[model samples]
Target: MKEEKKPYFPMFVDLSEKNVVVVGAGTIAKRRIRSLIEFTNHLSVIAPEVNNELLELETAGKIEIRRKNYDREDLYDADLVIAATNDHQLNNDIYSFCKCMGILVNVCSDKNKCDFYFPGLARHENVVVGVTASGSDHKKARAVVEKIRTIL
Candidate 1:
């Protein structure tokens, strides 16, 4: 039997006034962006093209939008990053870059390559509940988070 190489330690982070970049504008990326935008207005989206929702957010001046491919230089001052692009190789590259730079990163494609797992969270009043299945079962984590929402 093989042992699990990575162990997930869950914790909350303060994203306020932080430079956070989401490297995709697709469904998954948009979902993550929504959560991030609530925390920080200093959000940036990098992609070749963006969806209507993301564009609308950009138009509203909620975030900084870069309609182009990811550049390695983008990671320079990034405090936190989410690699949610469709290209597996690019996402992995972003993960590696973040790893080398000692930046906190979440690779939505490959959890093993991720420095952190973005947990399913529910914010209620002043309390926030986050749940993770160690990337083993995301559905379960979301389901639990949903339950927490109702109880709060």
Candidate 2:
């Protein structure tokens, strides 16, 4: 018997009122945070220490930064969670927790553990495009996103 892998559907969501939480503050997490902030106002970041840019965003009231280790309590209000920690175990734990809570989760290090994959985005006035290579080729997805951006 063989397993089947279904393609991820292209579903555009409204994040304006959703509570999005990113569980790491490193470069990968930062990029996700940056993209999310453009669409949602209720974004929370949890980590022991974050970079200056995140600190500035916190100071400016764009996102909430919790300067501490991750706990399940931190996700109490999250509608969507991005597990972007460098610690694989931690990311897995977060994924399990999110699953139990029925929360949508993206684990940056493991596609199999993710409930959703972040897409390369292109946004123009009154239009938004999302592109992905199904977690196989990010560079290709980005190139396509760039082309889409130019078209927009």
Tell me, by lDDT, which candidate is best: 2
lDDT of 2 at 68: 97
Clash numbers, per candidate: 0, 0
lDDT of 1 at 27: 90
TM-score, candidate number 2? 0.93
Off by over 4 Å in 1: 1-7
- Per residue, candidate 2 scores C-alpha lDDT tens digits across 40-117 of 989999999998999999999999998899999999889999999999999999999999999999999987888777
Candidates' C-alpha lDDT: 0.86, 0.92
lDDT of 1 by residue, 1-152 (tens): 99856647777778788999999988999989988887886999999888788888989989898878899998898999999988999998998899899998988877667666667878976687778887687788888998999998
Ten consecutive residues with minimal summed lDDT in candidate 2? 3-12
TM-score to native of every candidate shown: 0.87, 0.93
lDDT of 1: 0.86
lDDT of 1 at 88: 92
